[model samples]
Target chain A: MKTHTLSSHIISYVLLFCIGLFLVTFSIYYYFTRSTIQETTKENAVALANNTVNRIELVLNTEERIPEIVAKMLESSFLDRDSLIPFLKSILKNNKNICGSSISYEPNYFPDKGMFYAPYVFRQGSKIRSTMLGNENYEYAFMDWYQIPKMTQTPYWSEPYFDEGGGNMLMTTYSVPFYTYKKRERTFSGVVTIDISLEWLTKIMSTVKIFKTGYAFLISQNGTIITHPNKDYVMNQSIFTIAKENNQPGMRDIGRQMIKGGGNFASADFKSKWHPGKLWINYKGLPSSHWSIGVIYPESEMFASLHQINIILICLIVVGLFLLSLFTVKIIRKLTSPLKHFADSARLIAAGDFNVQLPEIKTQDEMKELYNSFSYMQKELAEYIVSLKDTTAAKEKIESELRIASEIQMAMIPHIFPPFPDLPQVDVFAVLKSAKEVGGDLYDFFVIDGNKFCFAIGDVSGKGVPASLFMAVTRTLVRSISDKEISPSVIVSTLNKSLSSNNESSMFVTFFLGVLDLATGELRYSNAGHNPPVVIRGNGDVIMFEKTKYIPVGLFEDFDYGELSLQLAPGDKIFLYTDGVSEAENVENKLFGEDNLMKVIGENVKASPRDLIHNMEVGLAEHVKGHTQSDDITMMTIVYNG
Target chain B: MNVLVTSSNDYTIVTIEGRIDATSSNEFEKSVMEVIEEGNTKIILDCSGLNYISSSGLRVFLIALKKMKAIKGQLKLCNLQPVIQGIFDVSGFATIFSIFPDQKSAMER
Candidate 1:
């Protein structure tokens, strides 16, 4: 974020920036426009002033030449009085402004060279100075233009003096001094002069235009108004008297500076009966003629449009702000209202209210998707939690039942140590443990008759209470058969036949039974598709009876069971177990296979049955540490005394 | 109200003809202001033909006299009617402004 002045930080900053931009643009435009107007006006003034001054000079010069032409004609020596009179009359008829014309002579006169056409004459005889009207009434010395031209030495334009006697006119006269031949010397002669009315100076300012409320007037180089449309300045009155008379402000100061100040446009604030405390002025001086012209107009009228624009701008800003604020409020409310509802629903969801629902939105936008997703997640989460809880309860009940069934299954066999203490030559220990879900892998050993002992270990194909029940039945049948003095193979055959009878579910067990003669140290075992039993020789060498079998018990009818016989020496051990014992796995998925189990038993073959069992359990445990037990494990060991 | 003054200074007659109403009062004040700006504080206002006086019109004379007094100069008001003078008296402006009966007397003072 850029730092800015405190005042610039506002929502209205945008509006103000826009307004400022517009004003700058407008001011630039107005500046160029005003400059163009002023330039055009100045061009017009210069053109008009120059052209009018030249035209007026030309007109005056042309008119002044009239009387001289007539005088020249009348003074010709060849003209008689009759011809002269007629010639003079024609001159008057053609030139209306020439009330009269004259030809005169005065001796010893030297008129200015440029002042008159004729100059430097002494008195000479036989002159032709004449006037068409009153031709012979007076001597030429008494006439003003005639005498004045003869006495001067240069050309001049006279003041606009009044003339009452000749034509009662305010006029300017043009004169010419002339010479006549006398005794071979050029003698001075009076001048021939004619008057033109100054009031007829329409050429001075030709076709000028001034504003309706403005005035244009002439001022002398001395700041005296020569001619004004107002009749008050008939005499040579300056603003000195006007200021004192009117008691107006700055009138005297302006008059004082008018002559010295080079002509230019200027304004003067004045208090007067005409206008109070307000003035608008413009002035220009004709440098060649030493005459100035001025104009006045009001300043307030110039900026009237600016004031109007200000009002319009203010109104537009007000309306624009009102609309903008209104839009902001409406849009914010529309955008956030739905979000507020969703927030409330989310809080309810947090409180575990599965049935909580949000308001249905009409538009299928992101917000709607969010609301739908929330609802779906809530419903799924509730169902998952309920299912999880129910699963946990069921698991606990099943495990509890498995515990009881496990105990009962163990009780149905001989798990007691030292079952026959009197028979010190015989040692046997067995163990059967069900998995958490309850499985049928059991081991049992008992004395059927006097010197005949029966031992069996079997594994049910499945787990849970069904497999345990099957194990109970199989154990009972094995004990009964062994007591009936049947061979081990016959016992396995009978057990399979009895288990397979009416078995609709196709359930089965892998059974291995053993029969031993105490005096001869002979062990007979029958395997029903079970893992082979491991035997240890008298030299402490372990051998697995990896014999083949036809089928498992309860799998087929009339199946022949296989038997393996071995005579155990006094220090030899025999190990029997189901596949569960060797296949027990840990989290590392390493099974307690037959190789490791055989090594453990062979090394401890000289130990008692309990010690051998203990060594086997420890070896399995060591091999299968940190691993999940995949199946129930059962192991049995027996020691024979020859 | 209108204000008028007719005076003669150095043999030049200064006839202040016409009304000096509230509108013209500004011009009246402006003339006085100019005079003071020029450092000419000695002034005589001959109000002989004055018909009416208003607050706006009198303010010019009051300002002029105040300015003249600060500059250690004098401003004299000559000729006054009872009504015009009454306004001056009520505003306590009579004590501050110098009054004369005629232009000659103002010039003399």
Candidate 2:
């Protein structure tokens, strides 16, 4: 059997199991039902037959009184051979099925000479003749009843036998001896005997009859079936004989008797005279002649069991019918799942979007076939969609390239830094994190010659790539020109003259520049409209280094940039920043003002350049927490270790 | 502190020379924009010549770039030195302008 999915297989298996259970239950019921009916019917037949046989035996027992009567008659009056005939004739009159009754006594017939029934009257059909009475050849001494009286020297009875001379069946005889003795010296007087008819047995059985299909049968303890309703079937016939007639060896076996309570039963399907398919049943050894009686009907008519079996079988068949219906419905749904997908595809095709594809279902069934067809349609539709996406794809690609270029611009500045690492004499740090693609803040530093450290800071007025370009050009010019040995004021004055000539945009830088002599405590510095830097002394006083502000560089030509010098101690620091730091905002849009910057410096008044820059950033953030910054932020701190 | 600047379309290119700190920052801003009145907004600073920069120098660059913005022209850089190039990489300013390997290459762009 092929395996099925869980739910459906469980249903089918449970149904089959239930059907099997019902069938077994019905079979058991059928067996017991048929067996009960068969046993009861056999028992009734045997009991009824035995009753009839016993009734006839009573009449035969009454006939038994004749011998006692004869014995009394012989004892009361002395009976010579002549008187024996009248006595026997009187006893033989009334009963019809008996043909004759007679008695015999003689020394020649007795096995022992001391036994006697002499002067005895033995009658047969109303006469006692000489040869029948006194003349005994004694060769008949070998006869069965004669030895009983001769050996016991008393009375004897023999079963009925046919007397062919009279052509009568079952004429039984009883005999008795007349005896006299003084002290154990008994004299031999011979025996008295009487005969009886056996036709009375048949007469009683004939009145109680059974139906045609039914048979009332009897068996002897010695395996004989006698008085089997059919008179011709009377003697020596038994179940064995019937089994031999049927040629079946199974009949020879004694069938197992089923005993439950009072019920003792046996049945044979080998009942037929010629075949065993028909059932024969019996109850045997009925108290009398080792006999049993039974009523045997044709096995075909034996429906006591089959009737109940049919009912249970019907219930099983009905269950099987329902199970088949459920099975078909479940299997059909599995077969049609792919059709649902096809319908979904048709809807998608109508909507003019055909990119969806069917999922894989790997079965060599009808559903898989439908999926294959849908897969083909999906491939064609997907190709059509792909062909139409050219313009959209190119636009996305350019956008991505522009994004990369914008990131490169912002990154070109020192977005994070300790701007001068090796010059411990001048601790410096700067940051130029952008708010857009670019911003105009710029800062630079390097050892121009030995301990002569040069640095500058400036800011552009606008934002984005354009402003960044200007910042780049201006930054490069400053870095290049600062290399020439000159005072800070002269270098800037030269640059101012250079820019003022073509300053059509009227844009200018508010800037500060410085050159440090590391061996001495002096910083040559200049300012061009830039914020005054915070200066921290070696002791602890913080002061603003504000030179008289000049016009921003690049505004006009021929403007002088004044320079000043401040004596620095070994631990002096200067903090420089663009407005991006002082004007920083949080998400609340609150500005981080100059007061906060001063406060931050006051708090970390003796920090190193890096720590000063970091502490100022912290203060700005604390002043304007949770607000987004509005401009590019750049700040730097430098310490002098002169 | 890295720099790369170039000149094109009638502008003479001038690149910054070194790290601009509190000491040299004001001078650095003055040197770069000195050519602005000479009609050179179409200038590219070869930031490759600049060794370092700080926030003060950033403020000067802001001031000069705005001047060019008002003048209605362009400035670009060519060839950035690596350390300053990393700053540009971090700040996302590489997207803000055109950059090239040299003066002639930037002028061609």
Candidate 3:
């Protein structure tokens, strides 16, 4: 899980939404704007075509009206040939648009003027000149202006022509027939005509403003191009020829509709020697001569404004989104600064630098509250750790003191295994173990007067320091008393009297004191309410001494103690122990009772005192495996080899 | 070991139970001495509930007996289990202390 920060998430989502919105809005705007520009360009083309047609119509209408008015004046009062020549010259002089005028009568209608008598007046530079146009080289009856008006008895406009005589120029003629009334019937007299130079019309068509790379062209009713941006097409190519050359049937169809004298606007893709790509053509028919005025604009040029606006809009949106992202990132960084500092502090705290200084936050917000909580937690943890360390130090001091006390207590007991090595008559060994740091169990043996060997093993009533002290007291009392008294009973009785008199704490000890007479192989022992010792004979017979039990010492003063004696042969051993051995418990809580103790002693009947004690300890250790010793264990073995 | 000490008139009845080994013998002694220290020196040890007694346990009873004699007070034993009576009889404890079969006789003494 790679994760983004909270502020980064916000910035990403906001930017995404903004970009999406911008795209949607821009798409709609572009579509409508493109359509609007297309429609506007189309309308502009149509308006330019219409305006060009109106100018052409005004010039053609004026030329046609002049011929008709002149025809009516000549018909009302017949003019002589000379007067007619002046009249035509004045007409050409008065109208700047008219290039020339002519009148051609029927053959032989005027006897004096021949069968084709027609006079023409035209402008050469600034001068008006007269010429006879009805000569054999110029056939008046075959001219389209003369023939059309004479046959229809109406006014007509001729196709543009380049005249080689009678005022040489490219021109279009408008003709009207004059008739005479005889006996309520009209008779055709002559054709009156006016020629308009097409140069001015070509100039007017070229002046149309249809953006750059756009042009206007004129097509006659017969589909011939009259005026065009390409000079080669003028008077040379038809609209249908250009359409076929461009391989566009749609352009041909527009040409057909245009030449039908019906106005229309259309667009088509036309590629020819003169034009390429898609073009928009708006054709309008002129009412005067049925010529169609067409305005053409390339689609690229027409939609150029739309493309420019689209690019601007896209650029603006991209820049806007970029700025938005920058602002979002800046705000997010500023807002999450506190969180970053908090995280750094948290990391330091986890690394165990609890006292690390946290960054201060002045804003009274959740971050400040969180900082305060962390600071408090840091202080509390430091205090708690300090107190815990102090408590541990105190506990360790007590434990070490107890260990020293245990050491001193162990030192007080007789730890030597072989006491009285010089006496070859007896060997003795003893071991003591405390359940706690210190214990009450004790064992001691010493030679008295070179002939009497006195040994004692005792169990004080308790454990630990108090019992240890009591054990030391009991051992001292027994040692001091035994030095003055040879009898075991006398020593214990005196020791009891000393301990019981001042026993305010009610502590006591179970003691067995024995005096061995080496010369006689006799053992005299006092048992003060203690478990009786076991004696093993040389014959492998184990005997438990069960005689003369007195109350334990340190319990009462002046209590008479009893003594028992046993005669031991050579190789006989006596085993002494506190109850810790017999009462030692195993994992099952079963005590190592006296039966087990006797069984261990009986098995090692031929063993020395050291071996006997070792065997018993091993047996007890095995029986109490995985269990704690609940009491003090003391064992002593004395072997008398007599 | 647990010692329950109850006094009736001049005599204190100390009921002992469980094992009075080296570790618990101190507690037994302290409880019995507390009764004696209160001037109830005419003590009777009821050993019917006493299952085991160690050498240290015997030392407490001996100290109690000596203290009673010094005070010129009597100490008696009653309701002793067979195992305890065997220990008393073999060690010649029966000779030193007055023993009875029941508490009534020990109290009458």
How well is each residue in B5-42 modelled by candidate 3, as lDDT tens digits?
77776778888889887668768878988888988757
**Per-candidate clash tally:** 21, 116, 14
Please give, for residues A1-642, the per-residue lDDT of candidate 2 as tens digits.
426644466667777786788779768877787778666666666666557656755675576566666666655545555666666555555545445544555444345534433333233455543234333444344566666677777666554456666554645566666553435665544455666555665555456554335555544344554455665556545556656776756665532221110112345645555323566554433332223445455555555346656767787678876876587657756665556667777788768767655655778876677677777777776676676576568867766765675566555555545555666666677767666656767776667777787778776655555557667766777776877855899878877776667766555666678888888867898877666778877777888765344655766576677899988888888888876776576665455766788878888877766787788777876876756554667787778875
CAPRI-style docking class of model 2 based on DockQ: incorrect
Model 3's DockQ?
0.23
Question: TM-score for each prediction?
Answer: 0.43, 0.39, 0.57
- The DockQ-derived docking category for candidate 3 is acceptable
Superposition error at A552 for model 3 (Å): 19
Consecutive 10-residue window with the lowest summed lDDT within model 1 chain B: B5-14
Residue A451, candidate 3: how far off, in angstroms?
18
If ranked by TM-score, best first, what sequence of candidates would result? Answer: 3, 1, 2
Residue A260's lDDT in candidate 2: 10
